[model samples]
Target chain A: MRVAFGEAILRLGEEAEDMVVLTADVAKPTQVAAFGERYPHRFLNVGISEQDMVDIAAGLALSEKIPVAVAFAPFMMRAWEQVRSTISRCNLNVKLVGTHSGLSASDEGSSHQSLEDVALARVLPNMTVIVPGDREEVKEATEAAVKSPGPVYMRIGRDEDVKFLDEPFRIGRAVVLRDGSDVAVISNGAITAEALAAAEGARVDAMVIHVPTVKPLDAQAVVSAARKTGAVVCVEEHSTIGGLGSAVSELLSSEYPVRVRRMGVNDTFGESGTYRELLEKHGLSAPHIRRRMEEAAEKRDR
Target chain B: MSSAVELADLRHATDVQKLKERIREIRRSILEMTSIRGLHLGSSLSCLEIIATLYFLKMRHSPHRPRWKDRDRFILSKGHAAPALYAVLAEAGYFPKEELRTLKSIGSRLQGHPDLRTPGVDAPSGSLGQGLSIGIGMALAARMRGSRSRVYVLAGDGECDEGQVWEAMMTAAHLRLGNLVLIIDRNGWQLDDRTEEVKRKVPLRGKLESFGWVTYSINGHDIEKIIEVLDSAEKSELPVAIIAHTKKGNGVSFLEGTNKGHKLKLSEEEYLAALKELEAKPVCE
Candidate 1:
């Protein structure tokens, strides 16, 4: 996934003279190394200064440059004020890329894991938030981001080998992986795979909604998907407050009030562990999602 | 070409007297804007001369062409001074001066602070101390793009308290952004208190110098002197910081020299008095 991001940026740099990359001293880890090396003049490494990185990106946008600032998900929120005031309010064309999202940064401890980025980022006006599930999705999503106007918050994970099934990707559109009438498991990012796995194990007919765009969300599609399934279960490797589950809940409550069982980290940070261990500990694995889905489906039937 | 001839030509081309008239028009628009939608009237007052100098004398922009790519970039780092920039930008014909009446109104492009959504504004700023870093980015972009167009940022002394400003300074120096110019509005007053008591920047020049920026200090209210220094920074091959010493409430006598004048809603009587005080020709130009 990281390599895909680098390749997409490299292509963007060739076409868009104004396309520049900035790292909060996290380029190498974020897989922006190739873009940095190829375009040294355009790459800026403001060592460990996330706040400065955001402000500088806004400035570059002011000078008619397309600035892409890269960092970990947690650090992106650390400079949240700069993002709100400088980028969003200014309507500067800045692309904020956060790597190592959710439990994807397994073993890096809870502090490095960002489970609440989507919830907070979406609340800000004029910010488009995206979380691609795998390598192919990352490439497609980033390319779409470069063409889109205004501010964007894109989240990618640390895992590189996750299978990215060949599918058309567009900003703010949900990809329905299956058709089902009993239940729908809506998910994003790394948890999309888990949602697929959960659907396979479900006793009743189930479907998966792979929504990459969390903000300026496809409300109509999500509501339609919910109405079809009758019961919905939102799965993610993020917090329940403001991640995929929360957004789905907000939409459902206002538009299509449906029963939703949210399967994610419930208000607790993950401890240091392997990816699989963390998933099990936080009840974010396929089994947990399946269990939650079955329970919600039974309740809906009642 | 002789240096004296070039200086004389620059002055003649700038047309200082015509610029003064434009400043009056800007002031009138600002007053009208405040009457329609009250904003940072006091902070706006503090930066009038600097705004006038940049738009009229320093910057290479055509009022007819606000989106000209090669024109010098200007960011109001002290976003609270939006009223001043809006006034000047309108008078300079970036937009119709009538749009000034929509200052801070709902659905109006004129936000409380400088925002790019508004025409002619490069970046949005309300959070203090981040504009400088944005300016550095613009400066660096111009350098990498091999454009001679410069980036100028006007920062408030009070905003220097933010640590991010220093971080931006370090980045700018490290990059040797010769096309960037920083003009600090040393108005001495901030929101609730004097800058010295709040965050003493007594050795501001020394601090910037140590950070590898070539420095200049001038009376901000003096349009001619400011024009000279600004021209120098534009021509220089190193990032320069011009500390413009200024009064908080420059044109209005009663509010001048006091921190209390930073943000206030003048009474009907006080508003008239302020206008009367400003009716007289400025002491320096």
Candidate 2:
């Protein structure tokens, strides 16, 4: 999923004349260094300065340039204030792509892992938030982000490349991978692959909906799915406090008033472990997703 | 947001007398605008002459056509100095002088800090230590487009305490952005107290030179010196940082170099005296 963003930058750099790529010293890890190598003049490496990268992107945007800033998701949050004031406040067209979102940082421990970027980016007034589920979506979302008229924040995973999506990607649109009336399992980001597995692999008879755009969410699709199933299971690799879970709950409770079970990290920092172990510990693996889906389905019968 | 593109037409100050008169008018406007809220008085007062010289003489911008493609860009990194910037911008016809009274009020285009909502503001700024980085971005973008336009950023001396300032300094030097210039308003005072008292930036020029910039130390209030340095920067191969030495509250006697100038805590008598003092010819040594 990380390299997919770099591949997209290479493809788009040729067509988009005004596109400028920037990274805060993690160019190789985020895989944006390929663009740097291909077009040295268009790429900027603000060594270990995310705040500088963001404000500089704002400056570039003001001068009729589209700057895509890539970085580790956790460290990029260091410049959240800069994103708020310099980019989002003024509504500049700067694309921000974050790698290792959620616990994908894995053994890099709690500090490197990011579980709150979705909430932070979602709350900003002018930012469009996207969390791609697979390698293909990361590339598609990166292209869509640059096409967006204003600011965009895309959260991508470190290594989850579960490529199940075969449909055309569109902003603010959800793709239904499974169809059922038992319950609705809705998710964004890499966890959507797990949600799909819970519905398809386990024969759970639950509707699986992949929502790539968290902001300007596919509200109509989500509400329709909730109304059809009468129950919802929200899954993501972020904190359940204010991520896809909060977004789903906030939308469903007001619009359709369905029973929603949010499955994600319950507001605790992650611990060091293998990626699968951490997912199990945080209740984000496909088994946890299946358990939550079954519980929501059983409770609907009551 | 106007789509109209026009050639740059600027009215340069013909002499020192004209420039000083412009500076005096800017001070008067700032004094009147901050009467109610007393917002950022010392910060505004310190950078008037530098801003005045730029708008009247140095910058090539079209007032009526603010988004003109070929125009030079100015960013106020020391955004608390909005009163000074607004005064100069209005004097240059970016917006009406009548709009100055709406500062800090509800529904005013003018905010406490410089906002892009206001005409002629290149980038929105209030938080310190962010402007130089923005200037570098603009400078690089212009070069990529093969345009000769330049970007100027006016920052405060006390604001150097922010680590991002140094981070931006490194990038600007690394890029060798010849189209960018940074003017540090060295008024020797900040909001908390004296800059050295809060944090010592005494060897500011030496520090900047070490950071790989072509540094220049100048009397910030001197119009001719400001013009000379600004003109000379165009030929350089690297970014330029100008440390402009100035007094906190330059025009009025009681307010100059005093904490009272930081924000307007003046009594009616002192306020009238300030206006009367500004009515005289500007003191340029």
Candidate 3:
């Protein structure tokens, strides 16, 4: 995931002279080491202070530089006030790349897990929240973020996520992994792999929509899909609140009001375990989504 | 009033009386706006003359071309003190003087803090202690772009309690950004209590100097002294730090030197008294 982000970053640098990157002591871990090695002047490592890193990024952005600040998701939370005021308030061109999102830091436990990052980032005005499905989506979203006008929060998993899409997907355009007519399964980030697996178990026509950009969401596409299917099931590896499930719920509530069943981590803290075990323990497996979809379909039949 | 001469000529001319009148007018604007808006009355009074000197006789900012590439940039890092900044910007013709009345009103671009979306503001500031870093970024950009434009940032004394300010200071000095100036509005008071009691930043100049900054101290309300020091520092070869000693709520008699007035809105009687006191003060040096 980090390598993909790095590749997209290099491409953005070639396209935009204003592009700059800052890291809060996470350059190596986020795989921005090569960019740092290549563009030493444009890259900054501001020690361990995430708040200062954000402030410096905003400062760099004040004078036409498109600053991309990279850090662990939990550490990025330390700079929320700066992010809200200096970046979002000013509407500065800064993209915040938060690595080890959700329970991707499973062994690192709840301290490093960014379960609430989406909720926190979504509330800030002028902030675009994106959680890419895999390495391929991360690359596409990073390229889009460079052209994005204002602040953006992009979540990328620490582990190598399941890659379903072989082609570059347009950001904010949900990719339909499976084409069905009865129900649409909406998922994002690393968990879209599980949604694809669960699609095989559907008794009725089922489709899986992959959303990379959670904010400035493809509302038109989601509404159209839900209206066609009459029912939607949203899944994510993170908590049900303010993640993929909540984003879909918000969209459904206003634009595409449909019978929706949200399958995600139901407001629980992730434990110390491997990523696979954590997903299984939290019922974020393909079978869990399949079971939830069948039950929703049964209710609609009644 | 300053010699009946244009702003460009004021740089070389030391007309203290006319400049003092400019400071008084700035104070008048602050008092009137604070009475109407009921916000930043204390902080506005605190940095009245500092604003006057920068806009009137110190900085080279063009109102017609706010985004002029060669113009100096100022960031109010202590953004709650935006009334002073707005009053200065208005006097500089960044906006109409009458529009100052829209302060803190719904849909008014003059928010409680300095918003870059507004005409004169270079950066959005309010969440404290981040302005210096932004100035550093600006200064670095100017250097990289080979432009001689300078960046100035004003931080509240209390705002120094934030760790980000220090980080910015370190970055600026590390970069050896001679084009940057950091002014500490040493007002001694914050929202809740006195800065000395809350979080003392004694030897403030020493701390900045330790970061390889060329430091200076001056009476913040003394426009003449401020201009002289700033002029000398601008010629220096290192990033400059000016610890401008000021009284919180300096212009309002009832509020001056009082911690209670740091963020308080004036009542009807208090407003009337403040007006009377401002009217009695000498208009010029």
Q: Taking the tens digit of each residue's C-alpha lDDT, what string does model 2 give over A198-237?
A: 7866545799999999998899999999989988998988
Residues B174-219, model 3: lDDT tens digits:
7788999998999888887888888888878889889899999999
TM-score of chain B of 2: 0.92
After superposition, which runs of candidate 1 have C-alpha atoms over 4 Å from their true positions?
B1-14, B28-37, B282-285
Deviation of model 1 at B118, angstroms: 3.6
Cα RMSD for predicted model 1: 2.5
Model 3 chain B worst lDDT window (10 residues):
B8-17
Fill in the DockQ of model 2.
Answer: 0.73
**Sort by lDDT, best first: what order?**
2, 1, 3
First chain TM-score, candidate 3: 0.94
lDDT of 3 at B243: 94
List the candidates' TM-scores in order: 0.94, 0.96, 0.93
lDDT (Cα, tens digit) per residue for candidate 2, span B175-278: 99989999999999988899999999979999999999999999987888898899898889999999999999887788788767887745677778889987
Chain B TM-score, all predictions listed? 0.92, 0.92, 0.93
DockQ: the better of candidates 1 and 2:
1
Best by lDDT: 2
Docking quality category of candidate 3 according to DockQ thresholds: medium
Candidate 2: CAPRI quality band:
medium
